[model samples]
Target: MPIEQGGRVSWGVDHLPYGVFSRPGQAPRVGVRYGDRVLDLAAALHDEVFAAPSLNPFMVRGRAAWQATRALLREKLTNDMAVTEAHLVPLEQVRLHLPFEVADYVDFYCSLDHASNIGRIFRPDAEPLLPNWRHLPVGYHGRSGTVVVSGTPITRPHGQLKAGVFGPCVKLDIEAELGFVVGTPSEMGAPAGAFEDHVFGVTLLNDWSARDIQAWEYVPLGPFLGKSFATSISPWITPLDALPRIPGPPQDPEPLDHLRRRADWGLDIVVEVAINGEVVSRPPYASMYWTPDQMLAHMTSNGASLRVGDLFASGTISGPRREERGSLIELTWNGNDPIKLADGQTRTFLEDGDTVTLRATAGSITLGEVSGTIR
Candidate 1:
């Protein structure tokens, strides 16, 4: 059956993504969204293929299995092939949980526009970009243990800034990024092409920041306790195969053969950020300087290994326009200018009680909606 036959689900067929869900009395089970209900894949297939607490076991089966599951599920869903009412659960009645266990977390500064803007603001005296920025993807390892599923409240992190002043992160900011989930493990010496084979899907990630603590502690080492406090991600994982390809910009002074990804790494994901109920920014994912494949390639260039469920993030995807900025630091120019809100309020950074929502859409298929409130 064609996916087009299943009329307008919240995240329909093309988005045919997977996640973990639990009902009132049931334990977590892998499920797929179809129309306004969630189909219990395990129950529908009458097997334990999707019976795991997270989607890791199923996702680790590689792309062939992923396609098979999607095809079988799509047919059962679209044509009502073998699905029964018992296998379908109402979306509202079920609670969504973290879809995968993050074995490792890595984040990349892949957006040239975002990097350049931040560079000018923080290091105005010298050239905005470092010499090696364009040569390779700049990234740092992050705390995976603290990664929370969407809707989880982020506590205002407490830390020092300029010798114990303006603490509790007066500059509580949000970095809107698209994260890639690795389902297949890679060898230690794998090259950029390995990304195509290892990466499984994508998700919306919010790297909440404490700008003051980061400013004080970032030197010598990248980030520490400030960034480790909390990070939020969407519940659903959208497979890479479900999305269309939009190639990234050409690399000047071409990369080495090992780093060159001949295939399309760019994804035309439209990412939006909103405060309360008003939309603030809509940064285009295509504006990123480095692609996902390049980041994966560059990450392992030094003989590093890739693990299953390892999450890699594309940081703060800002665009050419002011309104396209992904972080509050760029949007409000480091609190000098406050952005006006819909409810007759203005904010330079997130305040307590403020709910921030990050959403990404690819055509009619929504990757996921990752939202959290500042506390």
Candidate 2:
């Protein structure tokens, strides 16, 4: 039977984001989102690569294969809709899993506004930015093992607080961000231009934070227990080819030769961060200071190898406006000012039952949303 198209589903032919999904009795397999359905790639294309539980096996096939598969998917879905309709599984009938097996996770602080906001709030008496802020894309290796799929419950972490006291996190927060999925592997180093060759797709990310814990421990080495507890990501990975890339924000001092991009890689993704059920912030990705390509180049400039399924994210995507703040610390000014919700409640930080969701769009393409409720 032909799939009925009635109501609006943001997912269309232009946005065939890939994910791993499974029916009740079936094992997880690769599928692509089409309208409100998931087209089983293994069944539709007769390829075992899609039979794998995660996207890693297919991603290892490299750029040419990725491009060819995308083209074939478009062809089958459009011209052969009658034959392909049989393989379409209703989105609700399947459970979405992490699209790929994450090999390594790196989160970069690439937003100028977000960085300045943090500096202003924490180091109010000092200059807003660190001296080395403009020199490079400051980042920290994140715990890949803790990266979870959307809808996963995020338990508030416990750690040492100010005055050497330890307790449950009081300042639970969410960082609305964009994550880049790596498909192709590289040896010693990859240049800025090689971002397209290595990256497979993009996904929405929520870097759950324990601000109180972070404030006490992140002085010399940066975040540990405060951030590594849980990082939620959207199940669908939107192909890089599907997004619209605009010119990135200009750099004050031109980047080093290795970090200089031959082409603009800045994404025009607009991200919305919601608390409980109310939309609180709408951070603009185009306003970010460092591009993903520059981040990759800088990451690999020191001879770090890129592995298939490696994930990297653009740190909080904030803008100049107060409403554009991506994290609770900045949005609330470190709990100085509370945000009033639609239900007549004010929140300085996340409560035990609070749910945070991060949704994004690039032009007409709706990237998958990452949501988690605090437990």
Candidate 3:
């Protein structure tokens, strides 16, 4: 990929996101994504760390190593492209696998718009946000085993609709969100200013939800079967060094000292949601009420240790406008208002054959898209 005069491509060398790839007879190994190709990191760098099937080995090396490796990759890709060209593999000729092994999965309700919309839809007469919503980043533990790579087929999950009722999930939905990849592990205590140090990268995530099932079981505790069925994420993990940070949305009542923002970690990536090839929503990430740094601080404030490949996602990335809603439940107003597709078919939720794709971009650099079809 040729770097333009200003030094950026649609998917540029500056954004050399990493992932694991395999050819027909080869074992999976780490690679970096260039424009239309994957740079075999193991072959090009001659490092056995990149020869590992997952990114965990490289990620556990901590921040200093991470930064040094990134700098080296840029130098080689830009100035030494002629020598490194032989290791470049076309993206179409390889299979992309899950980039890292997930140690734990946590999803946060960080979007005020999504939370408010959902509250209004379900509790029309009550307050839109819960009492403790603004006070902290509300979240729930999710099943890490179910997390899968992009393009994996998602079977519609089944759960109890009411008491003693069980069947296929009729109100299947998608939550367009961004996931944070944890690199360095930390012992107990809060990581207030260590967001960039510990978080290695970001990835587009689609938290597939069963609205009816979620509504039924998420009363006292939180999500269970409705959410754990499947979660899809982009194959490429864009390093934090590549994303441009900006000021996040202002919090109404200031957060506590522990939850305070130490740095401008608010990412300005724009996320686009498409259903069956038609663009529907373009949810802005900058609009999220709670920043990832705060979420990290809150997660470890209670003596929770961070793991090498732990993944935490910013729950549905919805905006204030109707077109900016991230989930189908919010877009269609809990099935009361159905969205019309280009094919003239109105949809309240995902059908068995429908496909959902989420793409995101920060300025000129396009993040790898997470796409999945219902089976």
Candidate 4:
């Protein structure tokens, strides 16, 4: 298959896509995400294990494996004879694993609206943004061990909740976010630009939070127990290249010297969250103040080392428009007013047995969705 001669066409599927595949009875092996289906690398090459020629050096290795896989699939798919009759599995039948194995996790607070909303709740007289808000992307190290696949069930995290000064606490909330999956590694102490070519895909993520715990311990440092209870990601990874290009320049204050990219960067993805079975908030990925490229470029500037599966989450995506808020907390104004669902139930936060699914569509030909039930 000759992919190089495919020309300078702008194809989203070609840019950033990966998946996991295997034959019936065999455990799923990694594959690349394609339109309406997956390109089974393991079966296409007919290898018992994941190793194959021109592919052996990259398979299951790291982002390099994904980079290699992308190159090969483009060749094979372009010619249309790489792997025949491999049983095109119904996309719904397959269980999704976290597209890449994450080595570390980082959650960033780059949304000014989220920052301002949370801040106004406490210090009404002071400004919402921190003094360092415009300097760089603010982030917190997260627990990688708790990162689960798309369909996994999430147990309500148990934590202390203090209601008032020396009062018993009780409240929990979930922060909806868009996650970034790396395709290449960056050496520590370098800059964010190093990750531009290293990034492979993006997915919807939910960063669960305990508002009660957060209100108490958040004085010097940011979230700890209030933040790290449980986190979820959609099963499929939408390649960055598959996303539609944004039309305008980056949000103002621009970015630090290290976090600059072309104006058209960032994928145009429509993101939404459904509670129980009703749709709540639908925020477009374009609403983000900072694009992933700026985020990556800023992250690496400190010379931080990243692994093949290191996940970077954009803190709750909120827009200037009221309906564009990504989380219920922001939408309801901290439960000042309750949102009425189609079923006549009210929700300030997700409840037991409540299921939340996050999904995004790049176009009719490409998309990814993930849902999980609360236990």
Measured by lDDT, the strongest candidate is 3
Q: Note the Cα lDDT for every prediction shown.
A: 0.86, 0.91, 0.92, 0.66
Off by over 4 Å in 1: 1-10, 81-84, 189-193
State the lDDT of candidate 2 residue by residue for 61-162, as single tens digits.
988998999999889988999999999999889999988999999999999999999999988999999998999999999999999999999888988988
Q: How close is candidate 4 to the true structure, as a TM-score?
A: 0.83
What's the TM-score of each model vs. the native? Answer: 0.95, 0.97, 0.97, 0.83
What are the runs in model 2 whose C-alpha is more than 4 Å off? 1-9, 189-193
Candidate 4 residues 139-161, lDDT tens each? 87888888877778877766556
Residue 90 displacement (Å), model 4: 2.5
Clashes of each: 0, 0, 0, 18
